[model samples]
Target: MWERNLNGKDLQFHLSGINNENFIMKDEQTGSWWQQVSGRAIQGPLKGSQLKRFSHDDLTFATWKREHPSTRILEPDPSAQEEYAPADWEAETAELPVVTPRGKSEPLEDRDLVAGVSNQDAARAYLVADLARQGPVNDRLGTTPILVLPFEDGKSVRVFERTAGGQVLEFFAGTGEELGRLVDATTGSTWDFRGTALAGPLSGSQMARMDVLLDYWFDWRTYHPDTDVYRAGL
Candidate 1:
């Protein structure tokens, strides 16, 4: 028989899809639900590490789909994991500072939307990816991923950071001009968006979210051809 330990202080949730196994319990620090939200270890004795936190990136989404027999492997509902991700990036670079979230404006709710996971660690994945794919980059961090079109080269799409403290993701990039046009088109504002959707920041999954976000930005132009915007093109 499998031994089970349940703490009365923390509520338990039986996640059925995870390898047909069970993972549950609430966080002691916060009473938020602790569901397996990220990818597995993939190696080591602890190789199948399940992310028991709400997440949106590829790893988490993939895990969520693999275990669940029915749920489609789509991006985690952006709102569900919005806290860790920012809601705005328009002023992320100019007004924000460092690579992390600071000041009182940063809310705990968004910081640990997924509970146990570290937003700092999640943000770092984005930084590393930017470094590898592109050669040399200038960015910090703030509420969202800042897209600095520093290069005139074909390097239009890049995940720029705001500062070095390592907290926010200014927003995704496709040249600074491209961003201006988007603002002109969408009145939805960054307020309604979160994580990669609104903030342009990457969370648990970096490349996965980055690819989707860029693809989405590009696809939007298809419908607004008459806007006369995007003359520069991505």
Candidate 2:
């Protein structure tokens, strides 16, 4: 999510239109158009201005409820129930023809799902299927070391900075009772899906979370053309 307050003004936004399959938001205050993906103002008085992004996660409802039981959810407007998309919207949309240009030599298909991580001016796209098969992935984004963990539920993914206690840590998938957990090689600390150290010498330590965007390969590639694709064992 993005910060709506910019330049001392709290702006309200509405869906203005679509650009390259991404939603365009128009602010009520200045009537400026903002790109949904980049959160940058593309037109009007706020042109060239960028919105600060808030950290968010792409998690299943069950996982979220498990994490935050008392959290309040935003319910849909009862009067506008008919305006909501149906359950098969995603499946139907995926089958629709993509009008955007794509190179035939691209590493992944246009519709392939990817978890994109960006940091320190560098970006990388990790294939969701590869992550699911490989388990926890220890990798670096530019100079920042990162760890990607896929939840056992199969739909949730999280990214965290692997540096903790002045050391870079590598993590592997846990087995047996520790199933769905991450075990660090350095301290042997067992971490849950929340990136919290549950045991070992590093108990009580928390790994810094990073914002990750779960998007289609085409959408991510369209914005981050220079992004590197992560491959297993490479």
Give candidates' CA RMSD values in order. Answer: 18.8, 1.3
List candidate 2 segments past 4 Å from native: none
Q: Summarize candidate 1's per-residue lDDT along 122-232 as a digit string, tens digits.
A: 322122223224532333333444433322222223332333223333333333544422110122223111112333232222222222112121122222222111111
Per-model TM-score, in order, reads: 0.19, 0.96
- Stretches > 4 Å off in candidate 1: 1-14, 17-35, 41-107, 110-138, 141-234
What is the Cα-based lDDT of residue 145 in candidate 1?
Answer: 42
Clashing pairs in 2: none
For model 2, residues 3-59, the per-residue Cα lDDT tens digits are 998978999999999998999999999999999999999999999999999988788
What local distance difference test score does each model get?
0.29, 0.90
lDDT of 1 at 219: 21
Candidate maximizing lDDT: 2
